[model samples]
Target: MLHLHILSWILAIILFFAAYQNFSDRQGPSQYFKPLHMVLRVFLLLTLISGGVVFFQTMGGGMAAQYGIKFLLGLITIGLMEMTLAKKKKKKPSRTFFYLVIFFALLTIGMGIWLPMGPISAMFN
Candidate 1:
């Protein structure tokens, strides 16, 4: 469980950096962006799975509801990120998709803070 928590934080950090790179115009289609995007996807998936495990192991009923919401939001954010990446080389990234990623990422981070001491606690509090 502790290992999972550590991995989640590490993965989140990596994903955040990758997202920043993508947003900063430092990455592109044929360059480092694609691989970074793939890594972010894998890391996000791992984070979600580890979080689910922690939630189920510790909180069973309504306590787990928060985790479910966070998980769904994470999935939506991942989808928006995927769409953004798919549109590489376009004149501009979709502002709607970009905003969705930012919103959901912040929401997930907030939930990580507000929730109990789980894998994400280290990230926010």
Candidate 2:
């Protein structure tokens, strides 16, 4: 379970990079962006599943509260990212979308830092 948790975190980081790259590649003529986007979506789903498993396994009152907040933020981020992609496809990228992405990213990272000692702290410390 611990291994699964760590793997999920690592994969989440990788998916983050992949999603960013996909966004950057949107301005290019590459035929790979669509597939990459799909891959990122799949990765994000897997990350969520694994993270949920970890969450349920180690859940407590305080941690549950934190997890709920993080989960909501994550869903919001994912929705914003999807909307950004949609707007990008229409060639109408919005500054607000980018700001939302950045905001959620920072919030997620902050939540990771503030999470109780477990996989995250063990790896960082």
Question: Please, what's the RMSD in Å of model 2?
Answer: 3.4
TM-score of each: 0.67, 0.72
lDDT tens digits, residues 2-22, model 1? 477547646765664565455
Specify the highest-TM-score model's number. 2
Q: What are the per-residue Cα lDDT tens digits for candidate 2 across 13-122? A: 56545655555435652466677677767766776776677667657656787777777776777677667666765667556886887789678767866777454677
How many angstroms is residue 77 displaced in model 2 relative to the true structure, after the best TM-score fit?
Answer: 1.6
Residue 94 shift from truth in candidate 1, angstroms: 1.9
TM-score of 1: 0.67
lDDT of each: 0.65, 0.66
